[model samples]
Target: LAKTTQPISMDSYEGQEVNITCSHNNIATNDYITWYQQFPSQGPRFIIQGYKTKVTNEVASLFIPADRKSSTLSLPRVSLSDTAVYYCLVGDGTPSSNTGKLIFGQGTTLQVKP
Candidate 1:
C-alpha cells in the first residue's frame, strides 16, 4: 500500500490562489492519486483523480507526473471560505483497495485569511 504525505498547514490570503502537492513513493500499479478537501465540520469531499498527465474539474485540477511518484492539486482563486484541511490519498478500489483498508495521514490544514 502507498502512504501519502502532505504539508501540515498552509496560509494564504483571500482572493489568492493555492496549490497543494502530495508525495507517494510506494504507490501500487493499480493505484490512482486522489485528493480530498474538508471543511471545519464536514467530511472530506473528492476533489480530483488521475493516473498521469492532467485532470481538471470545477473545483480543482490534478497533475500527475509520468513516474507516478508525486502529484499536485491546484486550486484557483481561493477565498476565505476555502480554508480547511486537505487530504491526499492514493489507491483506487471499488468497494475497497486490495484488503479493503485505507490509512489516512494527519492531513494538511489550509488557512485562508482576509
Candidate 2:
C-alpha cells in the first residue's frame, strides 16, 4: 500500500473553498485515489475517487496528478456542517478489484468556522 501524508488540521470559514492535499510518493499504477469525510461518531463517507486527472461529484472534487503520487480534495463553499476529518486512501478500489481492505491513516481534520 502506498503511504499517504496529509495536513493534520486546516481552518476555513463558512462559504470558503478548501483544498486538502495528500502525498503518496510510492503510488502504484493500478492504485486509485479516494477521499472520504467523517464526522464525529460517524463512519467515513465517500467524497470522491480518481485514478488520474480530475473527478467531480455533487459534494466535492478530486484531483490526481499524472504521476499518481498525490491528490487533492476540493470542497466548494464549505459550511460549519462540513467540518470533519478527511481521509485520503490509495488502493485498488475498482469494482472488480475491490478487496474490502482499506488502511486509513490519521486523517486531516477540517474545521469550518462561522
Candidate 3:
C-alpha cells in the first residue's frame, strides 16, 4: 500500500490559492492519487483525482509529477468556508488497505482566515 505524508495544518487568507502537497513514497504504478475534503461534522468529499500530468475541474486542480510519487491539490480563490481537513488517498479501485478500498492519510487541516 502507498503511504502519504502531508502537513498537519495550513493557514490561508480569503481569496487566496492554497496548494496542498502529499507525498506517497510507496505508490504503485497502477495506483491512482486522489484528494478529499472534509468539514467539521461531515464526511469527506472527493476533490480531485489524477494519474499523471494535470487535471482541472470547477472546484480544484490536481497536478501529478512524472514519478507519480507526489501530488498537489490546488484550491482557487479560497474563502473562509473552504477551510477543512483534506485527505490524500492512494488506491486502485479495490479493497486494498485498512481504509476499505483506499489508503487514507491522517489529513491536513486548512484554516482560511478572512
Candidate 4:
C-alpha cells in the first residue's frame, strides 16, 4: 500500500490558481499523504493531509516538506466548476490495515480552460 505520483494533466483559466504535485518516493513508515478530488461522476473527496508542515482546509492547501517524499495540493481561485480529477494517496494508515487500498493511481486530469 505505497504508491503515489500525482498529476496527469493540468490547465487553468477561469480564475487561475492551481497547484498539484505529488511523488511518494517509496514513502513508508505508516505512510500518510492523502489528497483527492474527482468531480466527473463523483467519488474522491478528502482534500488535505500531512505529517510534516502546512495543512490548510476549507478545500485546499497541503504542503508537506520535511523529507516526507513530496506533496502539494493547493487549488485556490480556480473555477470552471473546478474541473476535476486529482488524486494522490500514499497510505493514510489504518484502512483496517491497508484494506486492499491504493486510492487510485491514475488520475489528475484538471482542464478548466475557459
TM-score of each: 0.90, 0.93, 0.92, 0.33
User: Would you list the C-alpha lDDT of every candidate in the order shown?
Assistant: 0.85, 0.91, 0.90, 0.81
Model 2: how far residue 84 lies from native, Å = 0.4
Top model number, lDDT: 2
lDDT of 1 by residue, 1-114 (tens): 789989899999888778888999998877878888888778888888888999999988888989889898889999888888988888766435356456678889999989
**What's model 4's overall lDDT?**
0.81
Top-scoring candidate (TM-score) = 2
- Least lDDT summed over 10 consecutive residues: which range in candidate 3? 92-101
Candidate 3 residue runs with Cα over 4 Å from true position: 93-100
Worst 10 residues of 1 by lDDT: 93-102
In model 2, pairs of residues that clash are none
Q: In terms of TM-score, which candidate is stronger, 2 or 3? A: 2
User: Which scores greater on lDDT, model 1 or model 4?
Assistant: 1
What residue runs in model 2 are displaced by over 4 Å at the alpha carbon?
A: 93-100
How would you encode candidate 3's per-residue C-alpha lDDT over 1-114 as one tens digit per residue?
Answer: 788999999999999999999999888767888899999999899988888999999999999999988899999999999999999998774444434367677899999999
